[model samples]
Target: MSQIVTLQAFLDHWAGSDPEKAAIASTVRTIAGTGVGIADLVARGPLEEGLARIHGSDPNGGGDTQKELDVIAEEAICAALREAPVAYLASEESEDLIALNPKGQLVVAVDPLDGSSNIDTNVSVGTIYSILPFTEADRDNPNAAVMKPGTNQLAAGFLAYGPATILVSSLGNGTQVFVYDRESSEFIMARDQVEIPVETREYGVNQSNMRHWDEAMSGWIKDCLAGKEGPRGKDFNMRWVGSMVADAFRIFTRGGVYVYSSDKRKGYENGRLRLIYEAFPIAMLTEQAGGGATDGKTRILDITPHHIHQRIPLVFGSKGEVEKIASYY
Candidate 1:
């Protein structure tokens, strides 16, 4: 009998295949512009250089080191998939949808660099990606290129580059976590079948933004508060780390809900989280782990991405609270 390596195996292999390959790719000459595919992006230079740059010690005299990290991540992604054969590429950094290998099987959406604000503090940051197959007609509508939701993703994953760069991915069946073995230049399986325990207690929300919340959100929080002190008769804890990836990673490891929603704040029409980059990937991960993700009204995956960096409200985690929050909406 032949061994059947899980889909996660392939992803892990890729993660370790090229240690220095550019993680992101672009062709826009300026710091901000439009480009295509993964090959044209520039390399991020050395790992130590990236580490130093990430620490705000870069001598480039350019923009913030986070931007440089973003570019590096973008380049790394491009280099990693230069031959992986993906079709359209939608990213948080680019305004235009990039056409790469038009006949390829996969359409990839990425947040090349997540949690850039945490770089200064040496906190954990990550890369989120979602993969969908190219539909027959999707090839024509540039905007409709990657139309599937996170629920329909063939592969969903994130690479956490912090104290140690780790890869977390799903291959439809289950989740896997791989740690970078720098010496061997390979990803070693540190965990498998990463199931998020479904306990119902704590919840995460940014109370500082409470003034901008909608009736539904505020109403739900009121209920949670009531449970904590008033009537519902349960003690509740609140957490808001400001970084979606960090907040979500904690939820995945622990058990809880995280919310960032549409509020009355100016410029918050669609919400703060990016649909293609942040919400979808996390939503997919949450769902795959027996958790739930919603936009208060609809499933996160059901909301098709209209733009590369389109923002949307997000609420996800333990089934109970997430459902309860959605019920309020």
Candidate 2:
């Protein structure tokens, strides 16, 4: 835990030791660098007029009601990547693959704002990003570059802009956490490799959707609620923040399981999370930090994306707890 250094220093080390990863190091830097600006915008909140006003549904056909900050965050990352060595930019905010540097060797998938629905409420919202090596198998089809499996990711991370602006990432090496220092306007490494407790007594899920969940899902909650009075012999805490990043940060800081499962609801059979950007990056982070992520039954990183904006169920947290939930199914 004593491994303290500025993000730039870490990046320098990352690139200096391996020239082949220069593109990845630079891309991570670009994402985190622009993330600072996004943090400021989020901090401003109501100060920024119409920041949370509904901008209409996502033009990408994801059916998400877009907010002004959502577009702003997406554009900020897009503009920044134009200067980085990025071949293509795929986002949940956009349907088409954005061609950046044709010569760039990497493709970046992003969720501009993970919890934009909570923007107007002044709750925590963050950005998620996944970096993949560019594939030239289908030069004419730009979407092909983004259809790879999560295992193909060179790097994945998310910026949780809560009370503290922390940038969490993994370079396939391990998960690293960086805290933003306003004094220097830079991110400094705050934690080295982190490990989640194998077991936890706390859990998170949107209880409002309890009726939509199937028996396995509802039964699990019921057992936990039963505490020592029912099948489960211990008390458990239930938490729901209505934001993925916020819930994830809690699990990372402490320990817990968060499930956003595929329910019986119409059009939500595959779950609501976009696989490429949201699930992939979070899965990578969780795994890197000695946790696990799954779609109730399957490993998230093992799924090959069929489309750039594909949605899937998401469940991740303490490995033991995750396994327990999977056993229920």
Cα lDDT of candidate 1 equals 0.66
True-structure Cα RMSD, model 2: 1.3
Supply every candidate's count of residue pairs whose N, Cα or C atoms clash at under 3 angstroms.
13, 0
Provide the lDDT at 147 for model 2. Answer: 86
- How would you encode candidate 2's per-residue C-alpha lDDT over 111-221 as one tens digit per residue? 999999998788999999999887666467777777877888889999999899999889988898899999998899888787888999999998889899988888889
Per-residue C-alpha lDDT of model 1 across residues 27-67, encoded as one tens digit per residue: 11111121111112222223334432443432222132445
TM-score of each: 0.78, 0.97
- Rate residue 29 of model 1 by lDDT: 13
Candidates in order have lDDT scores of: 0.66, 0.89
State the displacement of the C-alpha of residue 134, model 1, in Å, after optimal TM-score superposition.
2.0
